[model samples]
Target: MFLRPAARRLRADHPLALELAVLVLALAGAHLWRRGATALLPILSRAVRVDGLVTRGLLAGALLLAGLVLYVGVYALLRDIDVGLSVPSGRDRRSLGLALAVPPLLVGLTKLVGDLTGVPYNGLTMSAYGVGTPVPAVLASLVPGLLVGACSLTVVCQVLVQGTFARVVDGRRAAFLTTVLTAVVLSRSTGGLSAFPARGKLALAAAFVLSLGLALYAVEAVERDGVRYLAYLPVTAVLGLVVVSLIAATESVAELLFGATHVAVLGLAATSYERTHSLLVPAVAYLSLLLAEETVVLLFEAGMRSW
Candidate 1:
């Protein structure tokens, strides 16, 4: 019943003017929030006790956990009113498996691309783990990567853009719009249109588009064919290689990993919402992952500094 109504609404002629206006407003809001957060970071750092490794780790973890809670609360409040947001429903083990598998594969693909392109891949970008045989530094850096994966305003904006795209369009257009808009929004958050060299930014944007397109395809395949969705692997791998290669050419390995992982997470979140008609599941899962990653990275960075 809910699915039918939601589908019908998506197919109906929604006014493009209204949609565009809303999109502009959302973009503006996202920009302001990102700027505000950036500005607040210095003041927050000064106010918080971060002199020691333990203090820094605790502060970082607390802040990330707070953000996760805020996001979950917002999603819960908006779920009922927005067609794009949904309540969790039946479980799909296959979707869950796919979601779990995607992140590691993305990390591996980034490493492979970096090797091929002769880019120095710094796996421990968040921590100085290699300086000495320090257990705390290793734990601090690794724990976060294994835990949070990475969560930022970029991810929040992505969910908003992709969810909105799914509500308004279907098929390829929806996928394209989701990817393009995410890139535009994330780029703006990072440094506006002129942040990087034109060529570098273009390459990075194209990589995001390609990676997201493959991710969308994977989600659709899994939904339609279940286990037989393994058929999509080759295509996914090839596309990933191209996307990573482009990223390697234009950015650091850390940036490539972040982009690829974010796309994978976005795809997982979108697919989960589509399958279960619930935003809560994905939101919870994402926040949990992000919290873990942030905690580990912060701990590692603090340890490295103290050591």
Candidate 2:
């Protein structure tokens, strides 16, 4: 059932690459046609519309570019850290310090720009609703989730680097990093100028402590045993449910992959948890959970399309 042989033949012939290039050209042409067509349409209203085509295009492009830049930048930054992610040396505390500094910097910049531009503060929407409630609101709310997820993943990624991928062997240290990462990311996202005051700082602190403690313990256990994946059972179940729901509703492959990327990173953590009896526990646990979640969703999609 493997496609490697076929893939090799196609690759060697360079046919698949040419087809991919043609497909991309076709898609780009279609996108420009649709966009320009909509923009060129004659105005039919007697009322003065404040928002014009140029404004709409600019807004769309800016939002898209911002999201892309954030994704690439965040991933690259995490990749540079010496957190022993893929292999473990000692925890590169310097890299850890730098890693911890990132989310706040992002938060500050986003807030400053948002305030200066008079953009609506939508950061609180993640606490109040899931992405399925309303289409526009769901899409709008995803930005914060993406930002928060990026920050959270960085911690988790660092934990993976140090505990599983890197030369470090301390599971608890990895867990500590995990908790710190989560706290820092959430704090940055919640407190900056756009944050809501409803939860209050006291509550945030309490939540952080509870989350940190549990996360640290979970990681420590999962690193040492394969069947010990139970530490992340709650997270796995919740994320699995979310993935299943999205697969049932969304049609776009890009959206599915984007949603699943979070799950995939978590899965990496879970895998490390299952493999190493050392401090890599929580990382493996999370990675396994993520893998299960995303794989289930992807399989379901495949089945649906086959039918």
Q: Which structure among the candidates has the greatest lDDT? A: 1
Residues 141-209, candidate 1: write the lDDT tens digits.
545533332333323433555455555566345445654454443432111121112344434444544
Q: Estimate candidate 1's RMSD in Å.
A: 12.6
Candidate 1 residue 196 C-alpha distance from true site, Å: 16
- Report the lDDT of model 2 for residue 85: 29
Expressed as tens digits, the lDDT of each residue in 91-156 for candidate 2 is 433333332343334333433444455432232112223223454543353444444334333333
Supply the TM-score for candidate 2. 0.22
RMSD of candidates 1 onward, in order: 12.6, 23.7
